[model samples]
Target: VAKPVFMSCNDRQHSLAFGLPGMVERLNHLHIQYTDFDDLGVSHDTIRSKDIDVAMQLGKHANDQLYTFYSASPSGWLMELGWGNYEKPAAQEHYTGDIFGHAVEASGYGLDLEL
Candidate 1:
């Protein structure tokens, strides 16, 4: 994901983490404050096997199409992660951050919620 993972305090202080696929596992193993939300249907058994701390069970949101859960971050804040049915922009990028086809400029501050 190109987006940065963040934890904010009082709407001011923030901590950012950018990681790859197994970043969640690394965060858990390190006991760092971080949250992991799954969209795209992660295997519950797989998550459990990793012994990740689960703060909430799988559920849907009131104004979202996400199938997600919450995890307690080491920083004492809830880290929200999830996937949704929002249509991907008609643009593609390679794993090396190379743009392919057309590029779409996506902008938002908080979660990009569509209702």
Candidate 2:
């Protein structure tokens, strides 16, 4: 099987949760889903088992139900899609800095990957 590049396991799962609406739109364009690991039940555990460089589990925390992107790497496209992996952009200065990738009562700011 071809291992995925340019995406983390969290990225995959988060994309599934957050990008559903946009994904559905894209689905119509291609018959086969580009969703690689889902059918094989290749979730977080499975992907991790494969020794793939998906994501590093620093620890666990909980959050409310919110969807946001993280700046996961030193690349441009994915960086543009997510928060930059180091510095918070001026536009996102309002982030509450919650460590858990969960939604809060006031905002939906999940996925607390450091840039």
Candidate 3:
């Protein structure tokens, strides 16, 4: 199966909702397959717990370009952290970064959240 792309942030919040695909692609281009700097089953306060320099650098570049908080993208190794599958919660609020397919649109890449 093909791998799923996930966003990573230098900061603690993963819901920033911004430039992500480009960053991940950069990692892959460098032959770095491990996604890092993300907290899957671990505690939420461990940003410096692992080797995430590549991701950190990307975050710096991204932030420098957009001029906000850039350490928000995750490392290539982060993909291994695993953002477990969603089981369809009963009630929920639509968030900015939630995942949804744009089968209805030819251009695709629309951000959506489904409950």
Q: Rate the local accuracy (lDDT) of all candidates.
A: 0.36, 0.27, 0.25
Cα lDDT tens digits for candidate 2, 81-112: 22222322343334444465423221112222
Model 1 lDDT tens row, 1-115: 4334434342211324333233432331111221344322454445557775555555544332345544445553334345444332222521322112112122121222221
lDDT of 3 by residue, 56-89 (tens): 1121112111111112234432221223322322
Q: When superposed on Cα atoms, how far off is each prediction in RMSD?
A: 14.9, 15.1, 14.2
Which ranges in model 1 have alpha carbons more than 4 Å from their true place? 1-40, 43-47, 87-115
Candidate with the greatest TM-score versus the true structure: 1
Best of the two (2, 3) by TM-score: 2
> Using alpha carbons, what is the TM-score of model 2?
0.24
Model 3, total clashes: 15
Looking at candidate 2, the ten consecutive residues that score lowest on lDDT are 25-34
> What's the distance in Å from true for residue 65, model 2?
2.9
Give the lowest summed-lDDT range of ten residues in model 3: 60-69
